[model samples]
Target: MNQLGSIIFLIAIFLFSTFLNWYVFQAVKTLTFGLEGERMKQIVAVSYWLIFGGISIWLVITFLRIFQMGEINVQTQTALNVFLTVMVTQLVCVVFLFGEDIVRNVQAGVTYLVNGSNGFSFPERMRWVSGIALVVAMIPFSSFIYGVTKGKHNFKVHREIIYFDDLPDAFDGFTITQISDIHSGSFTNYDAVQKGIDLAIDQKSDLFVFTGDLVNHKAEEIDPMLDQFKKIKAPYGQFSILGNHDYGDYVSWSTKEAKEANFLKLKNQHKKLGYRLLLDENVVIEKDGQTIQLLGVENWGLGFKAKGDLEKALANTAASDFKILLSHDPSHWDEEVKKNMNKVHLTLSGHTHGMQFGIETPIIRWSPVQYRYPNWAGLAEENGRYLYVNRGFGFHAFSGRVGIWPEITVIELRKTVSSME
Candidate 1:
């Protein structure tokens, strides 16, 4: 964006933040009314101003950095994350305050209508309403804190057994572990990241697959985590495919050559991690007198780079073979994989990351990303074909995961017997 556009956007944020500050201040003032010795009042006042003031200062610093450095660096990205989460907490407080006002206004209107006098007094703000707001707002506030401190590293291993009637006999009970969207550029805690990798290694699955997005926009970002991720070994092999971020499309490079060079380095990093990087290619995993095709394509989706050629990737394979596809974006499955002439029995993806936040339980699974990508988060089947979208092993711009923790998926393939047999 131009300098003028940046300034306008910052100004808009300032105005909204200021309005939220006023509501929060008013709420605090009412809550501390007649409290013991004004000590509690002073404490709440100082805490609120300190946090809000810090946010304002951070906004100014990030705005200046954008003009001076021309883009958001790591520091600026972190500051922006803090600003957004705190602002969300303020918004929640505003909603509760508005509800309190509605209640007060309704009571005053009833009094005025019945008495029909100008002397009818406006109802005082409900003291308990402030307490309620504090309790309610704490929900998101604490959640953001936990997400940053722990949720990002809280990797959960999801295991599932899927049965196929046309399965190869030798591949029955074959296990695969998949992780995606590493976004190495966003990592801050090294030991925590290694812990997640170790958990995946502990699964000891037959095959390991990293669906996409090894870094944010630069190849060098994964340099530090290479050794840690290299330890994730499987018996069959470890394979990977590129996501949109691996192409360096989001950053400004000096020249086309430099971007191409960076992309090459990212592809090499996959090899360094002991993974066979697949770019619109196919590999046959052979076992006890049988074979299954594992086809991988480059980043191809509705809004992303359309470099992947599904037909080309499946060239050497036959339609009757049991085929599994490793695609970066779930939209690729929605748009191409399922509808292609060659049937892909299963497809794996991880682009949405479940928005890194959502509630998923046995009874219900919901995330904001569902509105955008119908095949988001977990398993979804269409026309006997299956797609499983991993929640992601790492985070990006948001810096945390709320309800949806980082995920590692372990899948077991089973052969189904025919009912007639």
Candidate 2:
């Protein structure tokens, strides 16, 4: 954005946050009105402002740094996460407080109408209402804290069995391990990340495929944990495809050549990690005299990068061959892959990360991202084609995961058995 626009946006955010702080402060004051000593109340008021003021200052500085740098550093990202967590918790408290205020005003108006000769005064704020608001706010505050501390690296293996009518006989029961959106720049705990890599290795699938976003902005971000990721190997070989973030589009570079150079380095990082990076290309995987086609395209998504060429990836491949495609964004499947005449049997993607927060259980599955991307996570089918979107292996802008933890997917491809047989 331009300078003026940036300034306006910052000013808007500052005003909104200050308003929230003031409302929350009022609730705090109401709750502490009956404190035993004047000094104790003074301390409470001072402590509340100090915390909020410190966070406000930190947010302004970090936002300025991000605007200047065109990218957020790990420290700044963590601080932003903290800011969001606290803000959201405060908003929850505001909801209850606002409700109580509305009721109080209504009661005062009723009293004025009933006794026309005497004026009605606004009632005192109830300590119990403020207490309830504070108590309820703790729920989300605790969840956000846990998400940052542990849930980000809490890798969960999602096992799926996909059946294909035209699957190659020799490839039946084939297991493929998939992970996506590593976002290496956002990682802080090397050992925790290693544990996720180790879990993927433990799956011991026939093939491994990474759907992309290896780094947040620059390829160098992966340097620290390169060795750990390199250990993820499979019998059929490790393959990968690019995601939108892999192209350095989000960062402002001094020159076009610099951006290109960084992208080339990121591509090479895949090779160094023993992955064959496919850019709008296809390869054949043969096993026990039967073969299947593996096609990978560059990042393709609606409203994002459109570098992937499905036609090019399918070039030189037979229409009758069982095809598994690797595309980073799930939107590709919704927009083109499933509708393509090439008849791709399966597609793997992982760009949503389920918004890094949601509730998923045996009875219900829901996330805000669902409204944006219908196939945000797990499996979906259209006609006979299947798409599986991994929930990602690492956190990103938020620096944490809530109900939707990092995921390592193990998919077993099964051939349909004839009922007559």
Candidate 3:
């Protein structure tokens, strides 16, 4: 953005933060009215300014970096995310306090109008409302703090059993461990990341697949941690496909050759990590004289790069073959895979990363990403075709995973029995 645009954006942020801070201060004062000395008051004052001021500084730095380099660095982005989370949580608290103010004001207004000036009495602020608002806000505040400090690498194994009548007999009990959107560029701890890889290896799944986004936008980002990820192995082999970030579309390049070189290096990085980087191609895996097709495509989505050619990948493949496709974006399945002439038994994807934040429970699952992509996370089926959207193995801009913990997906393919048929 130009200087004028940047300045206007920053001003808007400042004004919003100012208003939010005012509401927060009122809530805090009301809650702490008869409590301890000015100590609590001073602390709240310092904290509010420290957070908002730090955010403003971070925003300025971010825009400066963008102006200079045409992109924000990962560290700055992470810092911004932290501040933004805190800001949002504070806003949530203020909203409740604001609601309380409205109710109290309405009650006071009614008393004045009903009794007239002679009998009218001013209503006192209810401290309990502010207290409750604070308590409620602290829940998310604490959750986000935990998410940033530790939950990013809290790898959870999601075990799923999928049954298919047409599944090849040899692959009936086959297990596939999948991880997606590694985004190594955003990773800071090798040992923590290694723990996740170890967990995947421990599953000893027959096959391993990385759906996409091995790095944020550059191949070199994975250089430091290549050895750590290389430890992940499966009996069938490790296969990977590029995600949107793997193409270096977000960063500025000096020349076309430089961009091409970066892409080549990313492809080579997959090879270095011992992954068969499939580009719109199919590989047949045989077990006990029976075969299943593993088809992979480049990142394809409704609005993303349409590099994946399903027809080219499925070329020469039998229609009756049990096919498992590795696609980066779940939208690919929503838009094309399900509608394809040939049946794709299962499709694996990992582009959403569940927005790195959301609530997921047995009773209900929700994420902001759902608004954009219907198949945002977990498993969904339509027309007998299955799509498993991995929550992602690593975080991106937020540098944290809240309720949607990073996942190592273990899928067991079961063949439908004759009795069931």
Question: Which candidate gets the maximum TM-score versus the true structure?
Answer: 2
Candidate 3 per-residue lDDT, tens place, 91-161, comes to 88988887877888898899888887886776766788888888888888888888888999999999999
- Winning model by lDDT: 2
Model 3 stretches astray by more than 4 angstroms: 1-11, 35-47, 72-74, 112-124
Model 1 backbone overlap count? 0
Return the TM-score for candidate 3, rounded to 2 decimals. 0.91
TM-score for all models, in order of appearance:
0.91, 0.95, 0.91
lDDT of each: 0.88, 0.93, 0.88
lDDT by residue (29-118, candidate 1, tens digit) is 897787887788899888988888778777877877756654455787777678767877888888989987898899989999998777
Ranking by lDDT: 2, 1, 3
lDDT of 3 at 221: 94
| Better candidate by lDDT, 2 or 3 | 2
Candidate 2 per-residue lDDT, tens place, 1-421, comes to: 7899888977877777778888999889998898899999999999998989778777877888888999877878877898878888999999998999999989888888898647657788999899999999999899889998999989999999999989989998999999999999999889999999999999999999999999999999999998999999999999999999999998899999999999999999999999999999999999999899999999999999998999999999887989999999999999999998889999999999999988899998998899999999999998999999999998788998889999999999999998988
Q: Please give the TM-score that candidate 1 achieves against the real structure.
A: 0.91
Q: What's model 2's lDDT at 211?
A: 98
